[model samples]
Target: MNHNYKGFFSIVLLAWVDADYKFMWIDVGGLGSQSDAQIYNQLELKECLEDGSIGLPPPSPLPNDDQDFPYFLLGDDAFGLRAYLMKPCSGRTLTREELIANYRISRARRVVENAFGILAHRWRVLLSTMQQMPLTVQVIIESCVCLHNFIRIRNPAIQNIQLDNEDGAHNHVPGLWRQDDNLQDVDMPKEGNRDTVAATRQRDYLKYYFNSPVGLVPWHDRMVGV
Candidate 1:
């Protein structure tokens, strides 16, 4: 988050679990413009659920050093790991079964990308407004999320089929939203391609998080809901 560029935006990821599907982890992530600089401005969504910003649990061999606790751990990948950092496997290596389980878990994290797709095409925030002031940008981003979550939850009441395979895999069921052909402009990234390194890294980091032990429940069985 301390990084600087011509303009800056901090990424915020809202991930969850879905128990009924084959892949149960769903990650919904995005960038926060300026309104997110202070803690208060983020209070509404801060309490939304587990944000991975917290430091790791007390280390093994329990050190007396006060600074050992995690702090200032920025980035969306960090936040997404908060939920996966579950019990009993914090410092342990995963078994083969666990590895397969994690591979599936990693697949589920694509929900974040899908969510962004909806936001970009339907909401217009990511498509345009490329020049808003920092604070104003933040406000708009927050507003979109408020509206995003509202629509996401409320849609269930009327019976909808927008999200397919909430079981968490990178899947496309006929009843749900289809992959946008335009997405190919950015997705299906070419390996070793420098032009899209950032996107590639983001995908890798997401994979790394799912494959590692950073959640409270540990990547055990697919829960269908995060």
Candidate 2:
């Protein structure tokens, strides 16, 4: 396997998590040399999402609205945009609506971030170099995920203190996991593929929806400093 951008042999753990920070789907053992976009592009989950074979819910109207919207996954700029997947709008000069949309996506992505954070903080083994063979390391990682999900399901409060919280104004408060250096984020490539037409349209629609009367949250304008 190739060494990652960090110049060390590593494995990429691709995970899809829910709002509660539980893993919905995970693919482990990709060589770390690949960028996140590269690894994700090859995932079966991505294929399923694209082909609409993964049994996702159908498009539905947002609350108090007649306009229907497709269910989509929120990802960072590291991932490609798709009708089923939404990422932050990129660029330094963005509109107020675009900035609010980006802020919303960032807040949602924290579920994934804190999920990995709690996983690494509790299972400290992931934080260090494993001397074991690649196969063994894979099993160790899978086992940790299983146990992590089980604990979350059985006793949801097990890692409450480890999660990120929000203040009365909805400002983010970093979780305890952020204070630790156990798990570092995967390196993103400097460039991404051009957004597909459908993806661009969907993102634009969301930008409009998020700023509209129905989708607007009271704190959104304040959060984005609009």
Deviation of model 1 at 208, angstroms = 19
Off by over 4 Å in 2: 184-191
Model 2, position 48, has a per-residue lDDT of 88
Per-model TM against the reference: 0.40, 0.94
Candidate 2 pairs with clashing backbones? none
Whose TM-score is greatest here?
2
Across 81-183, the per-residue lDDT of candidate 1 in tens digits comes to 3332321111257654445444454544445445655554456555453476655665766666556666667664321444445334433353233455544
Error of 2 at 115 (Å): 0.4
Choose the strongest candidate by lDDT.
2
Q: What local lDDT score does residue 99 receive in model 2, on the 0 to 100 scale? A: 97
Q: In model 1, where is the ten-residue run with the lowest total lDDT?
A: 186-195
**lDDT per residue, candidate 2, 1-226, as tens digits?**
6587777888878888998778888888888778778888888888889899999898999788898889999887777788999999999899998999898778888888899899989998888889998889999999999999999999979898989999888888999988885455633454486689999999998888888998887788888888
| Deviation of model 1 at 188, angstroms | 14
lDDT (CA) per prediction: 0.39, 0.85
